[model samples]
Target chain A: MRITSETVADGIREQLFTIGDIPGVLWTPAEGSGPRPLVLIGHGGGSHKKGWEVVSRAFPYVTSCGFAVAAIDAPGTGDRPEHPEIRRLVALTQEREAAGEPFWSGPEWPALNETVAAQLIPDWQTTLDALRKLDSVGDSRPVGYYGLSQGGEMGIRLVAAEPRITAAVLGLVGSDWLTETAARVTIPVEFVLQWDDEGSPRDSVMKLFDALGSAEKTLHANPGSHFRVPSFEIDSSIRFFARHLGGPGTASGS
Target chain B: MRITSETVADGIREQLFTIGDIPGVLWTPAEGSGPRPLVLIGHGGGSHKKGWEVVSRAFPYVTSCGFAVAAIDAPGTGDRPEHPEIRRLVALTQEREAAGEPFWSGPEWPALNETVAAQLIPDWQTTLDALRKLDSVGDSRPVGYYGLSQGGEMGIRLVAAEPRITAAVLGLVGSDWLTETAARVTIPVEFVLQWDDEGSPRDSVMKLFDALGSAEKTLHANPGSHFRVPSFEIDSSIRFFARHLGGPGTASGS
Candidate 1:
């Protein structure tokens, strides 16, 4: 990975880097005495390394809690140029959405999903490989993963394939394709579920949760739309990761 | 089917009707002395009974050739009320399209495509059933099918299921899912293929044509984009349908 920029902000040292062809960011507590636990973030579709709007908001809180955060743009979004086929689809989607249209009920969704899955899983693994080699994050540094929606959907594959990730926070990602991946994830997990997600039905969400193979997993659910995750719930996820990755007595990392 | 409007212009009589819940239109020679051959039309995605602009432009010519023509809005388009799921999908498609975004490189396209296929084929069959009963049509009317792009993609299923369709003109649609459907379509076919379709690669289009089960089928290929079917090709399709559905010497139905 090649570092492109480095800056200090609010007691955090943030660096922009590229791992192979994938662009990413590293955020760590500037005053930490030793190597801190590392958290890899997966941004959703139409999002970038900064983790989209919702995800970007969490970087500061997670970093202040004494952990390093790293995130890369999902394959077709952010700094990575979108594939030509994907570019066409995004244009069509935007045109239809502007007309107040829906997208899921057609036959194209499944194929598009497959294309995206094929593109994302490898990048997630590559990002993880590059992050673990950085000076701020040694090979043995405890690694955690946090992703929701597109992030969570793809993170399942990453966590299942990479055993180095000690824990993961997965949310708003529910699909039958995850059944096998969920079964392979033995890491500590805190899965977030929103009850009324039009994009992802509740039953599918529950089915994904039910399929997780983790021995130590918790289900944190709320009754709201998929994008409406409450701050308290977000804190719970932070606490969950802190307990597992930041060592005991570090739950409040502050 | 319930006829709602009837008008005659330039020797063609056009009747607007509803087959079950699907809004449709019937075009026939106003001077036809008896029940002429019938050709059912399947409009493309985001289009209605009138067909997309391209297909609509061909209607009078086809009707003038001594054949009755019928077309209905595919599920979620045209006069038919869009399915709630479809509406959401269309809105999303529009939103993504307008943003110059890429969508299908993601996983959603396949699922949405299946939903559209499931909805369209049955509606096509139902419309066919209702169309045959019209006094202006009659039970023994020789039947043919015509569809392009979204129309052609979904028409494979309809033609395979509806044996009464003696022939079909399908083009500008190419997907692996059509392999099995194409294998089941035994009717005489005049398949159209555009060489430079960004939406449908040439190899896939040729593969679909090669997969057709028909003993007597022809490929009418041209060098153009998907939406730019040449006028001569349209005439060739008209003649093919005439040879299969209308009597000999009726190729020029003028």
Candidate 2:
């Protein structure tokens, strides 16, 4: 892992780093030195590691909980070089959408996600391995994943495959294809759903929530469209992770 | 309102009171005086004002948020004298259950709820009027309501009728009769649902949630039976009420 740039602001240290070809960003309390619980955030489709959604959650995880938070560009997002297949699939879906047709009804939607997962999932594993080696985010601490929408789509698959993730706050995507993968996730989960989400229907979102194998899963649904998740949910996630991963001043962490 | 008894424990002041023929209890921070946000807790079926469910939530609203909390006996429960009609209906339902039949399938279920709501709703309004007259619980402060199951049934009615209540946390009920009443409630609500609930099916609970008129309503669903709502939800309620009613130390309250 190579950190190409580092900056500090508002009591948080932000580091832009690269592991092979994957680009990522990490945030931690500026004053802390040793290991702390780390939360990996996955951005939504068309968004990158430093997107508003990722930064909004990362800031609180670092400043309030004194935890390490990281986000990485997916196969063709952020600073990563473009992939031909991903670009082609996204363009097809966008064109379908532009023509006043439902883009998600087409095969390209799932195909695009599959292509991204093929490379992004392995990239995430490599990033996690490198992150754990850092003194500020050692392997001893608990790990959590937070993602919504496309992030939630990939999160179900990643959390199911990655044993290192002990807990997750995921939702906003409910493709039928992820049902079996959701069942393999037995760790504690806090699933979110937008009651009026246009892209992801409430029933499908709930079906995914129901498929989760976690004994300690909670679903929080609010009335809103796909992009209008209430701000209070962010506070709820902080408490969820704090309960499962242990906050900085709490007994569970340093 | 007449105070029958008063006690202080664990930094909470508990007062047993009676307004006319209605028996009730109130809890508040033992250290402070003057008006604060008041949360009226409605107890579950076959339970009374001081039942475990009521006391558990009451204590936190008092000690944690420094809010005044209160609960009242339903028409046929607690210290209130029993009515023959309520007793007869309950006996019939209990007999049906003992016969390995679903008691809720019978007309006796709705009849029992209707019988209780007729008297209990008026009693709650009277108690609220009397409580607001107290020096420590003046009329100016915001009022919130918390109840589930039977309490939820009564709460949906009361909140719909009572303009004084500004927020509520209600759920665990989905009586078909309450849909119209639920729509009249426009305040912010944090509705709770217990998945796999034997008495309240998940779909019914969610349907009621959908009927709510409140634009700011949220649903928290956890995987458990009727009686197994996770303890974390209690903490979540504290935050919910604290946000809407304004905790004692916060700018929204004293």
Candidate 3:
């Protein structure tokens, strides 16, 4: 469990923000409650905020338990400002990154690691910082991070680079620089993965799960292909949060 | 499992048919495949033949597990010869039943209940019959029915009108038909409901699930609003078939 009974009652915000000039739906709980934790949701490669519908539905699991949820739209996809930050960096890294080893040598997009970390990550951080300022929400401080697929990778990056996000729930995060970075994070982490995720295989993801500096890490593995392998979806993971992220009545330690 | 390791082995043929002469896909297992089970896959409202990606992926499940898996296009949908099936049926039934009643109502292009039974259910049967003739799939029988949303309701009708299908698994079946047909079904059934289903309220669907004629039945509930409510996508359901429909070595009994 990332948060506990103490963190469940105070976090929830209804407003939203634009980080890196990107639109984000911000969810924070009622006021004067306590120091409530916050969560930022990221999406998949071909996904959008609407794609987070299921993930957001699980918000009540956290909110009812006492934490705020913010589902964000990654820059390139959503209505966020067309900042050329990551795009520019990706363009710069393209020829160079593409020329690197097999692990890093994929078709270069407009942004690569260093570029995305420098450009987009800041915008992502800005979204988190904004979450901390919700007037109706407690202290606006967050206790953990959670995301899926590509979002999972983003969450890992958030924790790796951002000291404020102390714990996380990352699922379907393939082993990549994002995950390798996850190793440096000292936060308690729980990873939910599926066998159907043929993308990078569990071994790859496990490598990241193993690298996490925290001794409190746990892994939940379910069978089935990436599509239908798990009988439980994000809903099940929310229950896991009840153990760590706090439950009803308690103030989520942000 | 209805069919287990002790079950005998029988081969079935993959059958192809049409709705009023439209192209369709069907598969029937070998003779010893007794009172064999049946499952008709209905495409989503706007989806078509290629949309049956779920069906094609699950054919092995049907043929192997002693099931008759037949896929047909609803009038104007899929490879089914596009015609006035949706319209003609609407005109015919509105006079006898409430426009809101079964065989008389709901999104049935021209009418609702009429399409549920006459067009949807019948076409499904035709696909089953086509299964019977296949040389490898000897047992020509019907014992189960399955559908999603609109297809879920159609599944209810097949049990009411055709004595062939004895069981069903309906997901997110839209309600509102109880007023027209007593909504009572005598078949053994299982329901997977989505609480906040955007397409239909959980209460509306639960009403339909509740009205079943007190037989052996089970209901599995999941979190998430309407859209995400129906567990898994087309592919997920296909895998569900693998778990329920038996495997590729399906042996028939009929």
Candidate 4:
């Protein structure tokens, strides 16, 4: 069989936005076309949008097989300006780490202003709405998301709260956040669990899966740690969005 | 309860390791008391040892709770010898992806050279002998191995080839290798599977677990993708190692 030349060129392109007074950077793909299924991503604790490059570059290899991906640095990471909520989160984390609280030993640094919680759900909504509004991305595509660690929580909340997400990939995090944000969601979800993830253990995923009000669900477990980033994980994320998101490359029927 | 800062510091520290063949950078942690259980980790295809920094460094965090950890990066990737086998594996991937042939996916990776194949079992032995011979790791402690993707296959082979491995962690790889290498292992094993991994999905893990010869075994499934590395994966890797591999920081008594 003759080999196909599948060209894959990737980069971090961005748009600036504000979550209230806090300035934020929307990290997205440079080569998106046709209503590329948007991928609104969030970063984990202590990290920002910079942590998302792995997915942005990798999704195209698979997602590009059919969709466009966009990731946003949470309020504090990357070029985004720090919000007052971030300050509160830091202060709370310090106090907890000082008190040597058990949660410190667990994942999640801290979120001081619970209102940031309210703003959090809208981050993806705002991005997806904007992406759909983009001239390049008209009304023909379904948006999706992939998040890791702390971002995993954000991704789950977004899809659960908004119907815009046709599909979603949650890596190393859980949907427990939905108890407050989304009581139920209809989209098909793919969950990627890291076997030895300390930040969010197996218990978290199990609990979250049980809470999922949706019936369309899939799960994959691979032996890995939070620190190890490799191509395999990238491949999975790409394949996932390719399956769920609607794009010129992937027909809604596919 | 007054929490000790030392414990927290140690818990967070196992996650750190010196990368590359910087002569000084070995898996051995800074001087600690007594000999600890040893583990040699190898990475999946198209990757190297240092390639696992994201996954392997947290071994110490597990160690702080008290078992020493070392992430093994096989020849090639993150500073290992460019062995012929590694070269072939890379070539196969490039060719297959270019071929764009759907059949050329999953564990269909070309076989390791007979030399590499024959040594799979012994390579681990050599690693153990080398570790035991090290000034830092003595023979007083037990040893085990853990691997992911391609590494997962190797971990099983290593344990199956050598009884030195008291426990093994296998994730997202072919289960047949266990059947091929079953006689060699006689330790506890943990298998993690994602419900919808693009490659080796959930059924694969159950098959591997069912075929395994170990008297002590457990199967864990998570909602995740092959690409989305999870926090639980890291937590489990470290926890498994800490329990099987004896050292100072890990919680003992498994």
Which structure among the candidates has the greatest DockQ? 2
Better of 3 and 4 by TM-score: 4
Top candidate on lDDT is: 2
Q: Tell me the TM-score of chain B in each candidate.
A: 0.88, 0.96, 0.66, 0.75
Candidate 1 has a TM-score of: 0.47
Quote the positional error of residue A36 for candidate 4 in Å: 2.6
lDDT string, candidate 2, B1-254, tens digits? 88999998998889999988999999988887777889999999999999999988999888788899999999889899978999999999999889998777789999999999999899889999998998778788899999999999999999999999999999999888889999999999999999899888899999999999999999999998999989999999999999998856333232
- Where model 4 places Cα greater than 4 Å from the true spot, the runs are A1-33, A52-63, A98-100, A104-113, A174-183, A246-254, B1-254
Q: Residue B200 in candidate 1 has what lDDT?
A: 80
Weakest 10 consecutive residues of candidate 3 chain B by summed lDDT: B1-10
TM-score of chain B of 1: 0.88
Instruction: Tell me the spans in candidate 2 whose CA falls farther than 4 Å from its real position.
Output: A249-254, B249-254
CAPRI grade of model 2: high
Interface RMSDs of the predictions, in order, are 27.1, 0.4, 11.6, 7.7
lDDT of 4 by residue, A12-104 (tens): 344555444333444334554444555666666667654545344434633355344445555655655667766766777677667867444
Best prediction by TM-score = 2
Residue-level lDDT of model 3, residues B1-254, one tens digit each, is: 01111222335454444435656655555455444455666655556543654455345545445555656667666655555755565555554455445442436433554554566666666666655555443344444566666666666666677665555666576567542442456665656666446565656765666566634444444445544533233333443444444443434353
Model 4 / residue A250 / CA error / Å: 9.4
List, in the given order, the native-contact fraction of each candidate.
0.00, 1.00, 0.00, 0.14
**TM-score for each of the candidates:** 0.47, 0.97, 0.41, 0.47
lDDT of 1 by residue, A192-228 (tens): 7775677777668767876888866655545467787
DockQ of every model listed? 0.01, 0.96, 0.02, 0.07
Provide the clashing-pair count of each candidate structure. 64, 0, 63, 52
In model 3, the runs with Cα more than 4 Å from the true position are A1-13, A29-35, A82-114, A140-142, A178-180, A229-233, A248-254, B1-254
